[model samples]
Target chain A: MAAAWHVRGLVLALLLAAVEGRAEPPEEESPWFVPDHAALQLAGSIGLLSAGPGWGFLRDGVDAELLLGWAPPAVAGEDFLTVTLKGQWHPFRPAWRGWTLRPLTVGLLLSYTFGDAYFVGLPDRYPDGYYWFKTALRPALLLGAGAGRPVPALGLRLQGYAELVATDYRLLHFLQSPATAGTGLFSLALGVRVRF
Target chain B: MDGPLRFAVLGDIQLFLDDGADAVEDLRRRDVDFVVQLGDLTEYGSAQEYAWVAELFDRLPVPSFAVLGNHDVLGTGADIYRRTFGPPFLSFQHAGSRFVLFDSNSREYAFPGNVPDLEALGEALAPEPGVDHRFTFSHVPPWNGDFDAALTGPLEQLQAERGVSASFHAHLHQFESEVRRGVPYFVADSLEHRNYLVVAVDGPVVRVERVFY
Candidate 1:
């Protein structure tokens, strides 16, 4: 029922967990409340580019992140800003020569755009059910994979990942107009993660 | 450019992208002087939807124009519409016929009452030489609830006085045609209905037909 800009978000934790997520408690026992990684992503539906903090859980199998996204008028055809909350679950982590890879990743995210024109709640303009979806908030589905390698000297891990994002509006249209929206249903996003 | 002025008018495309695409393909085969989409080009009026619809319009070889729709005004959609297709209101004379397109979706702005802009319509439809027929295009028919209730009568009266051959609209999502105050009003169905309208004017006579894609 709704479709907007092709923005994408979050895949920060999979690679962070792949690096030191084997639960080596004695090596670096930090507070669980502290974030395990930070990520900067390009073209994930959240924006043309976004950066955020992420937390890894379930022995690095699960990830939660908060991202701040932006799109400049030059690239997006106009200026746009968004905040996104994303969660992901990685199923497989294989290592080769000290580089860990997550082959399969699946996730969900909800994004909120910042502007006076957008509304979380319906204005007094129409009936109770004028619009079923909120213009300010967007929910989407995510599928992607990533790989990470530890840099011992720098005490940080470098990771790279990519995702195919299907926002709620796009998914809805895909369900109805398969022939028209089939190829455009999902937008691609690439991102990098730095494990602390 | 020849004997008769023939143009195609498409109603609300909305979410039916494939239908709209099919219509475009169907239109490419026909001989039309130009094409006018009555608006609601996008479902939510999002940037990507605008891009998709714009891409569709670009596929047409004939010159095409779109009026503003309520959905097209959602969020920053109006701004996007401007970026994609010039301004909301446009008036020009082509082949001895006056074609006027403007914004009539008053409820989108909570019905500030100035929508439909009769003053502008009066000026655009002013008596001019070589103009034997006049046509108007917009979203939301006057009878629809989305249109400003206060301005409907005034709008109809103005069209009647201006001798507008026919007023075209899309928003009801169904084909409807009726005469009010001696002027004919045509409401085009959404693209999902798979039907469009064709208007042809020759000399002082004008004819409209419902076309199926």
Candidate 2:
């Protein structure tokens, strides 16, 4: 428990450092200065918390992101930390009439999880497989589309987006299915992007 | 063609490799159609485990299909799975019915369209003029928020609208069956418990039974 807390603290510190480094950009008109976004997400079917930092950068019609996330190990479970390196390419750079109708983003992600209890089921649930953790590294792809309006006052950008991961493959695998060879669950993220 | 299409539904075999082998042995006595494993076939989705399950699943006299669970997505295990089992989501017609399988583990990756891809499922479930029943298979249940929040109500409504006979899912690791919107959602138990779901589709009637061995 203590070690998990320490790791959490370390991840938080790293996230803070990343945020501070974004304070100044090489160009004033660049999107590199866009502030980081943090969210408290309701993880999957399990009543667990998924909180993390999302960083974005725009350069020459392309948006790149680095998402550092942690799913605090559920009660009596270990912590799960993942670093995702993702980059998105938008076909149309900016909005033509306060509306960015032709914006398409394609993302590539490399994610890694550090922990022993990857999918530990509740004890009262599966008595046969009571307490077992499956942990390892994972690499996934995301193809998404987003349309958003810039909020200059609050330094936030509200965007509605959808992404598809691992669809090109021969099979579709979620992280919680018996057919899933590994932790390949699909996620749908609906949130806002903030810039300060 | 007049006989029932028999298949087995197993869930979250996870790291219980030995237990899964046991399940395979138990299945020897029962000769049926294909076998449908709900999801979580491996603990880490490792190639070794995938090989083990693949080999064991091959022992059956029928074709086998599986959905990907959270545990099976770790590392390159998912990739291994695609290499081994074909695809994560599968659709096939057997015994005058359509079987639509999909992924519903929401928190694993970015927006995955719809975990169960109800739109696709709905199209597949659309009254096939001549088909008798439609069955849907997925890893997570709509009741579990891990599924696409926006699609849950609509999915249940679609199932009811199309009169889907049953929707099978795992991941909860328990034995449960409930009717949501007139469609039965069956959550099978894990393999460690030495159990599997048997679906007998004969002509226009479909029967789902849980058996332990």
TM-score of chain A of each: 0.83, 0.57
Each model's TM-score, in the order given?
0.91, 0.54
Q: Compute fnat per model.
A: 0.38, 0.05
List DockQ, one per candidate, in order: 0.42, 0.03
| Candidate 2 chain B least-lDDT 10 residues | B107-116
- Which structure among the candidates has the greatest DockQ? 1
- The residue ranges of model 2 lying beyond 4 angstroms of the native Cα positions read A1-196, B110-113
**Model 2 lDDT at residue B149:** 76
CA lDDT of every candidate: 0.86, 0.65
